[model samples]
Target: MLFKESFSMAFTALLANKMRSLLTMLGIIIGVGAVIAMVSVGMGVKSDVVNSISSLGSNMLIVSPGSTNRGGVRGAAGSRTNLKYDDAKAIKEKIKNIDFVSPSVSRSYQIVYGNQNWNSSVMGVTPEYMSIRSLEVSTGSFVSESDNNKRNRVAVIGSTVATNLFGTTNPVGQNIRVNNQPFKVIGVLESKGQSSMGQDQDDVVIVPLTTAMERLMAMDYVSSVNIQVSDANKMDQVQEDIEVLLRQRHKIIGGKEDDFNVRNMTSLMETMSQTTTMLTILLGSIAGISLVVGGIGIMNIMMVSVTERTREIGIRKALGATFQNIMMQFLIESVVIGVIGGIIGIGMGCGLSMLVGKFGNFTTVITPLPVLVSFSFSVGIGLFFGIYPARKAAKLDPIEALRYE
Candidate 1:
């Protein structure tokens, strides 16, 4: 019955000063709301990066030419013209658990069809490159083995390239010029949108590797080799095997540096996941500072309330109210403010997330974990900050409190 009376008195006190109570909770509301929104944004970015990496291909690995040491001075990575089409062929023939290997080279060129021209990247790849890169031909066919073998001047254009160069016209079977060299369009690729790095995936053209090396660029070496593993579980093993095979092929022995670099998509994805997770934690921590400030606000207000209610404390003590009763009342008041503020903040956070998702360029993914965590933290802050003020109010001397004007 005493506890009930104390709680009732606490509720009445808050209701009597509605504006002050609302102002007291304002800090907590902002803190919790910021935490939820920021965490959601971080999670969305992490999801985008993972999905972007996955879209490249399943169990994928890329091998590129390493740096070269010429005249005792090292050049940048991929400056060595060591990666060849034969290296890719050897991997497919000798390596086990390999699904497909596509050797590719790329260069930028101005594509022209009639009067419309657009500068776009042109890649030379085998037919297997389509499956490896998760590319789909929307119309007509992709580069065939015959095309690569015969070094035919046929091209497959991306959606962005198609839109810029041909507009609405069907580009398949139409003759176009790449860097003033005439080529026939064999297919148009489906739209892939933007990558995680904001690069337009559909702003390129593809031709046969042989044609790119011998005819267009006149370069015999490939820039990179993309390999797909048949089994996801064997990705690491396959990467190691490829490294070993390349070392033997390049005649590098006795701790000599490799002439080629191998990269595993799975490892890249894991590193990105860790980076985004840390970013999320960092954002949440920055927002949590507001909660601490709100707790301090609660403590300050409770201290003022204690000073204002000194005479009331005296009267309650004279009426046989215990120290525990006074402490309970102030604690309840702070807790009530925190609870209400936390609820409002959750609604505000969710609303903000929805609005951002609807209007913003990036996505926002609101999860229940952040909501629960923020709410619990707010309540904890309230309870913790209320202790000192509640203790001071409980310990007030009845005679001194009563004498104070």
Candidate 2:
């Protein structure tokens, strides 16, 4: 009953100064709202990165030619023509736990179909390349073994390339000119969208490895070799096996450095996830500074409120109200302000996240955890800030307070 009476008095006091109470709550509203929106953006980015990496394929590994140091001048990785189509064939033949291997040679080319022209990346790959990269054909078929062996002038277009060249017409079985060389269109790849690196995955064409090597690039060396392992758990073993096999084939004996670099996609995924988690925390911390500022505002206003009601405190004390009752009344008022602000802030934050996702062309996820944390933190801030003023109000001398103006 005493607690109820104290809460009733707190409600009445706040009602008497509605504008002042609202002003005090504004800080908390902004603070919680900003924190929520920022965290949502961070989480959304993390989710997108994971999905993008997964789209590349599971249990995947990439082997690229390592850099070479010539006369103390080091060139970048893939600057050396050390990796070849033969090396890729050797790995597939010798290694265990290997599902598929595709040696790739890529170059940018101008594709012409009828009067329409579009510039896109042209990749030389085998039929196994389709499954390794998780690429599905929307129509027709990918490069067959016969096409690769015969070095047929056949091509498989990506969704972006197809749209640019054929528009509404089906591109399958049509002839498109790549680098002015006539090639028959065999397939169109399903849309894979953009990668995490911001490169368009569906803005390219696939041709037979033999065709790319002999006709298009006129090069014998492959740019890289992509391998998909049979099992995710054997990735480490498979990577080691490939490294040893390559080193032996290249005859890098007696502690010599490898001429190739191997990368595991699973490891890359973990590293990216950790990086995104740290970024999310950093953003959330920056936004949380406002919550601290809001606490300060609440303390300042509560102090002023205590001073304004000093005479009222005296009258309550004279009427046999205890010091605990006086303190509880002021504390409840501050907490009420915090609770209301937190609710309003949560609503505003959700709306802001949705708007950002729609207008900014970015993903924003409003998880329940962040909302709960913000509300609980706001309540804590109110309790902490309300302490000093409540104590001061309780410690006031009844005689002195009664004599005041």
Show where candidate 1 strays beyond 4 Å. Answer: 2-9, 67-79, 351-360, 397-400
Worst 10 residues of 1 by lDDT: 67-76
> Per-residue lDDT for 51-163 in model 1, tens only?
89988887899998983332476775445698888999999999999989999999899999999999999999999998998989999899999999999999999999999
Q: Considering every candidate listed, which one attains the maximal TM-score?
A: 2
lDDT of 2 at 274: 98
Error of 2 at 333 (Å): 1.4
Residues 294-347 of candidate 2 have per-residue lDDT tens digits of: 999999999999899899989888888788888898899889888988999999
- My TM-score estimates for the predictions, one after another, are 0.91, 0.94
> Model 1, residue 124: displacement in angstroms?
1.0
Give the total clashing residue pairs for model 2. Answer: 0
Q: Supply the TM-score for candidate 2.
A: 0.94
lDDT agreement with native, every candidate: 0.91, 0.91
